[model samples]
Target: MATGIPRTKWQSAPHHIQPNGLNSGNTDVHLSYEGKKPELEILNTPPANLRQLWPSNAGHVTPNRLYYGDNLPILAALAQDGSVRGHVRVVYIDPPYATRSVFQSRNQTDAYMDLLEGAHYLEFLRERLILLRALLADDGSIYVHLDDNMVFLVKAVMDEVFGRANFRNWITRKKCNPKNYTRKTFGNVADYILFYTKTENYVWHRPVEPRTEARAAKEYQYVEPGTGRRYKKVPVHAPGVRNGETGKPWRGKNPPPGKHWQYPPRVLDEMDARGEIYWSPTGNPRRKIYFDQSQGVPVQDIWLEYRDAHNQNIEVSGYPTEKNPAMLQRIIEASSNPGDLVLDCFSGSGTTLNMASHTGRRWIGMDNSREAISATLRRFAKGLEPMGNFASKLESAEREEESEDTLSLFGPEETAKPSPAKTDRHHAITDFALIAQEPGADDLADAVGQWLEWKGESRIMQFREETVPYKTGKPQKLHRAKRRKQRR
Candidate 1:
């Protein structure tokens, strides 16, 4: 797994390359795996089948899609399809941490299990990463959430799957407030998210943090007259000596020693003419920066804000390991634009999906756990208001259909076409599709596939009426009982 460039060689170079940071310099260093060929061959094999069960009646309201099943095969199916392959703009996955613990909902419903250990777990995640990489557009980016348990391993896998050159940031996120561990270790309160892009030219809308009161007071101490707006005066010169027009005389004044003008001489003259330049009492010239005109401060990698929801009032989904919506919103906003597709394969409580829908971004979500699916459905249902008492009307319509079915079974005469029940329920925003059993290539059309249409600014997907239960096998009992027994 060693790279072409030796550590000593890189150390002898100018910059100090951090181990956790991006390897930004020199293309000579490349991550190589001895078993890369076999892994690639295994990943290239397509899913056995891509069978679609039914369209979620709820899914049609928005361009979002929810798939129920393992993400590996679902991603493979997406790769096989023409419309979705190389079309996704953003991907955010918060996979199980291999903690070897069983997770349950607040009501003791079995959520998911994280039992795989060591290499097996690594390979399990690597296979999906391979397909995810193929599914991304050239400008797409991915953020993989992980704990300290396996962040380094996954980082290596990501570097190999996605070229090392595409590595972006190792963002450290403060997951919770604090932890008081009984064992001999420090409190674990943080997790890491590895961010990478598919190619050099990637979608990036720089994120910003709101200006704090203290920061605003310190940076913008000056007040402008007539308007009384907060302002700051910054030197018009920058580091590095230059011989260009920026280093030349401005109004017969030369640049300071070992510094060059931030702008050209003509530009400085124009700023002075427009009253943008502040002439100090000591004859020093600086540029005026207004507080309201600033776009806030640029966001950094080490995030202290946007912690996870700890209490009932703070958390919306109550799904175990559910992420904060604001965090997801930031990732979506920074990495994608309106109408672009966002993907969350391990969508637990649909936090990413909810954020994507609210922000006008199309999304696709997949999960194998039945509890996860139910949570997501309930979340979306509450968030979406049906037109009128449409729920009651739909129930009534369904009851009538049942009655008609009974009548048709008893009569031998030809059955008439049932009239379409129409309400103001016009445009749909989301579509739900299920991949039951693995089908062959011939079943592509019959399988669940989503088709989208735009109504003004909102895009809707056509949903078919169908439901296929997820096959998650037997549910595990909660560990609460065991802990209670031990207390006795």
Candidate 2:
């Protein structure tokens, strides 16, 4: 490839096209270039150890946390920390778009992924892909985002690194409206996203549930024969134990077919007497589940949620690097089950963690940029307003025990300081380099790393470690559990 763009200018007169010959050296046309700046400092102080970069929980945890650091160093730390090994279900990265924009950090060499003498930008992402693949669970998937410029190149490397056989889909998503450029023939209308699965057995959420018309017409078509009352049926079984002292069959002629009864004989008799049991003319029994109980269509993967944060984003951060929430939500929803740990090492503006928590998934977010970190924290604060209503119900249960300790303890302090609002990643890295060189942050860094791992929900699983698990063939009630909320 040509090392760089050559200088050029159009001659004013069409007939004077060859006039450029004489004025060539002293012509208005001029080439552009730059002298080098100091970028890399050979680490006089030993480079941060790769093994210790990760906090304890990095290799494990679903619906995990976000981490802020040089992603490459963090990846090395993960190689040892093992927090993500065989744990990640999906990887969705909106990698740098290869616009050849500036990338600066304390160590200048860290920024030069592709700006070298004979570098191909694709060469940069290749090394990261190797580790990212290692961290993926056997049955996992990955999605990589790019623009038209490098889509094909990135795709080929992804195929090579992750195995072409595991290829999933290439999505052409509408990124924005239009752009105008002098030499450009076509205005960019969209960019592309490449999806790949780790293995064929990977789990994928089907956005829609199937409806059997036969069942729908028979049960959900609740137009009564005579009274014409539109009442849908629901199981009449009152979940727990029943029947005086001994639990007996209640909902039907049988107790869930396999398990012991939920209610006693009398209650079962009462239910039968009330016609709660919808029996065929043959006297067979079954329960009715209504139509109104169903929520709307399950959310699909094609995201239309967050727009480029122009006006709305200013309402958010007005930051250039802020990611689309709709995109973040889709990634979180599709890859993680509720309560799973989610991590965003890049953690720009905390969009990933914010959206994850909004959907009830736990998250970890970190950013070298204090601005990004503060932006995320504020966004999360706004989110807490909605969470307050949902959590208010639970607050009543815990209040009596911790009555003296107020909710204010959970709130942010007046001293909370937000980072600079819109520093780019380069400047952010520069600031972090300076901070890393300074002395006081060791304790704070460790604390920040640890706090990112805390998800209050993990305590329950820890508590249950000693208890014997329930045995098979014993009936268990799973009524309260429904389809976990799918968000995007």
Candidate 3:
């Protein structure tokens, strides 16, 4: 069970029982029935005993932040904050996919535990999603990446949390090469990303891909003799009957009986005079579409180019389940603008953070594992020194050998104003602080207060108490209670 959340609210509906004769060994059956249902509940609940910290030497503060803890609490804390709430423009989370296996590193060191299965797994994700909804701006969007094991189930959960009407795309990404292991199923090579928006109106930067040589040659089959430029011919008349000017005659020829001119007759004449209309041997006039005028092909949902690192040399951080940076870059560029706030809660290797910074987007990354934090630190350290002209080289606090406790660094007073956007090739110093997780939010707050007393920057450090829990669960239909006859 997740802390600060009651089990009843997460599992309000009666558990559906699996039908007989189904193999109990198969986890797929768990999705069939006998589990908690999704529900939408009260949001705006605050996290208990939350603490905010900064580095004492930081000049200007950047909204980019990284938190070390279970994301539920971190997300709850952000949802309740006035400045951060409903301000995030884009969120991309690749959470544990309920694989029921403990992930380990190449040296056999434990990385993360994904043991929660069945209804427990569903409920756990549901609770956090509710908070995420409140945190998204009205025009913001979220992308949930999932492994094959849980994509279908999680899709249902997403539909319930974000209305089905707001659901965007079910993207299929080629995650790796074909697996050769002998198994009952086909070679697992692809995974899914469920995209959803807070509402019909959301931020969207149309993505374009360069047209391939073959496609370009095929589509632009015509070539202008004078300029030798590739072009295509399209019908100037469209499928519609109109009594307006578009239905009138052009060049002493009337539009086809069931069609209307795409442009006014005079406009068509002007295009013809400018050599923008192609006249076929039969005298049919078609509009000339040039290759140079196109905005490239719109990106599709089926992605095959970006995949996980194939070998150690190609690996960025060597963290387990690290995603491709190109993928993260695409998501950031397409869904968010420069200086927009981006979030990744299950920020395992910090791939999202790295891309977010490089792309000029402010970001917040949260992860609970020490190894994860260490990996993120290592990832940020590489090649950052060369970018010092635009970005300040990141500094990491040494981990104490004996205590092994979380450390909180107070940023400098210069960080109080919005940090300049790191748009140049050089890396500008992005305001960042690392916090150790305390037993309680109040404890963390007390630590912040104590540190502020010595540093004299209490105004910058803020904390919120987690008194009321933000309620969330997958949307599900509940059984109505039977009304009993009142005794006279």
Which one is best on lDDT?
A: 1
Looking at model 3, residue 118 earns an lDDT score of 74
Error of 3 at 374 (Å): 1.0
How well does each candidate superpose onto the true structure, as a TM-score? Answer: 0.71, 0.46, 0.69
Model 3 Cα lDDT, one tens digit per residue, 430-472: 3465443444334344434544454445544434421111211
Task: Give, for candidate 3, the lowest lDDT window spanning 10 residues.
Answer: 413-422
Global Cα lDDT for candidate 3: 0.67
Candidate 1: regions farther than 4 A off: 1-39, 56-63, 179-186, 383-430, 437-488
Local lDDT at 127 for model 3: 79
Q: What is the C-alpha RMSD of each candidate to the true structure, in Å?
A: 17.2, 23.7, 16.1
Q: Against the true structure, whose TM-score is highest? A: 1
Report how far off residue 47 is in candidate 2 (Å).
9.7
Clashes of each: 14, 22, 33
Model 1 lDDT, residue 170, Cα: 99
Candidate 2 lDDT over residue span 252-308, tens digit each: 354443233445567657866865556768765655444544543464434333334
Q: After superposition, how far is residue 9 of candidate 2 from its true place, in Å?
A: 61
Q: Candidates ranked by TM-score, best first?
A: 1, 3, 2
User: Candidate 3: lDDT of 301?
Assistant: 93
Q: What TM-score quantifies how close candidate 3 is to the native fold? A: 0.69
Reference-based lDDT, each prediction: 0.68, 0.46, 0.67
